[model samples]
Target: MILTVTLNTALDITYRTAALTPHATNRVAEVTERPGGKGINVARVLAALGHESVVTGFVGGRTGDALRELLAAEGPGGKAAHAAVSDSPVTDALVPIAGTTRRTIAVVDETTGDTTQLNEPGPTVTPAEWAAFLTSYEGLAARADAVALCGSLPPGVHVGAYAELVRLARAAGRPVLLDTSGEPLRRGIAARPDLVKPNADELAQLTGSREPLRATRDARRRGGRAVVASLGAAGLLAATPDGSWRAAPPMAVRGNPTGAGDSAVAGLLSGLVERLPWPERLARAVALSAATVLAPAAGEFDREAYADLLPRVAVTEQSSQPEQESHATRQHR
Candidate 1:
């Protein structure tokens, strides 16, 4: 089983309008909502790939109830309850809090394929709630093949929250993956997670370097056993203890990229659990990310797109020497 921790969960809402203009009222033509936050997105992708996953996070109020309902409704055999079934069922192990879960609104412009996001601050988590979460996490980690700690910390939770989670997972001898940003990421990296996935901007913010390779190495120096930096359309640049590699998509894909990072996380975690080689893991991540862009909605990946992109992605080994940055040690397509 795989355990995914989303400290701050949300009810994601996407509204599509004909066009978006500043200071103008636009009528929405369609609306879609789902259970979201980075970890939740990762779990969904994992489930799609026939992996049993359990999602644990904070939930409260009516919105939280609705989120749970949506999750339950999507369970195996299209069941109406939160009961697990055969194949890749997602089990809901969300911790209840006092405040209501937040809502994230994405306004998509049909004319330009651009998205404007308005996110609400999640409900504050009390000390008691945090304690309960830690206890639950420990138990889940013990049973999980791999654990993922993802997204932001809710209000009232300590900044070292992820750091504590990482420590606990490691103590249990579980391979842990972390995906987040800012101070939370900095502090969590110090706890030495098995892997850390960050985008170009987050890597730049943490290491103060715009260069993906250098920033990835800097991130690893901060205590990540391996670092995978998402470079948007350029694909992934990974620095692992074994070696360094870069995976690029065969062609540029344009669409809603909101959940591309989470899809990449799912790909990497799946590859790790399957014991695939580093280069293959990177290839899978890149393919999944590109497939996600082809999906019509966030948190979904196009199966056909992923299959087609899998073998087309180019994976090239990078020289350990900084001076040989331009040289590809080996290339696989």
Candidate 2:
């Protein structure tokens, strides 16, 4: 089973309207809410792909209750629940806290297909609550085939939270994936996770380089065993010990891209557990990310779109000449 950790879990609210105009009252045509966070989103995608996934994170207050209810409603036997592709179960193991969980708002413009997101700061976690979560995570990590430490750290949580989690997961003999940004990401990578998935902006923040290839390599050097940089419509650029490769969809799919990165993380984690080749894993991730863009809400991918795009994904080996040249230049210097 895969384990996903979302320290700052949220109630994701989406508003759909024909168009959003500045300084004008907008009429919303539709509204949807779901349990959301980087790790939670990953768990949903993994479950949809037929993997048994357990979601453990900090949740509390009314918003937390609602999030859990929504999650349960989509799990087995819930009114809105449906059988997973492989009938795999998604288990919720969220820890409770005194503080209220956060809420994220995504306003989708139907006309331009653009999204404006408003996010609230998560509840501040007490030291005692943080300790409780660690205890829970230790138990979950032991049983998990792979663990994903994802998303932002809530207020009052230590900056090195993910770093600590990575170390714990490693000691437990579980393959771990780290997906986050800013200082948390910097420290987490130093913990040397099995994989790190960072989008273009995050990559730039880490390595101070906007060039995908160079930035990816630099990120790996900082400590990640492997680095997969998501390039949005350009697809994924991956650098691993086995080799390097680039995966892209045949064409871009237009829709909400909110949870696309999380879907890619799900694809990569699933592939890792299944022991698929890097190229195959990259293909899966690319397909899933593109399929996510076609879905109406976050964390839901269009199954038909995924199936149609899987075989068509372009996975090409990248040349290592750039690295070799960099090495040569360093030697001369």
Candidate 2, residue 108: how far the Cα is off, in Å: 2.2
Please tell me which predicted candidate would have the highest TM-score against the true structure. Answer: 2
lDDT (Cα, tens digit) per residue for candidate 2, span 1-333 = 999999999999889989999899999998888888999989989988889999999999999999998887776556554322234667999999999999999988899988899999999999999999999999999999999998999998999999999999999999999999999999999999999999999999999889898889989999999999999999999999998999999997787787899999999999999999999999999999999998765668989999999999999999999888766765897
Candidate 2 residue-pair clash tally: 0
Which ten residues in a row are the worst by lDDT in model 2?
Answer: 79-88
- Could you estimate the TM-score for every candidate? 0.93, 0.95
In terms of lDDT, model 2 sits at 0.92
> Candidate 1 clashing pairs?
none
Off by over 4 Å in 2: 81-86, 329-333
Residue pairs in candidate 2 whose N, alpha carbon or C atoms collide under 3 angstroms? none
* Model 1, span 248-297: residue lDDT tens: 99999988788999999999999999999999999999999999998876
How high a TM-score does candidate 1 get?
0.93
What shift in Å separates residue 285 of candidate 2 from its native position after superposition?
Answer: 0.4
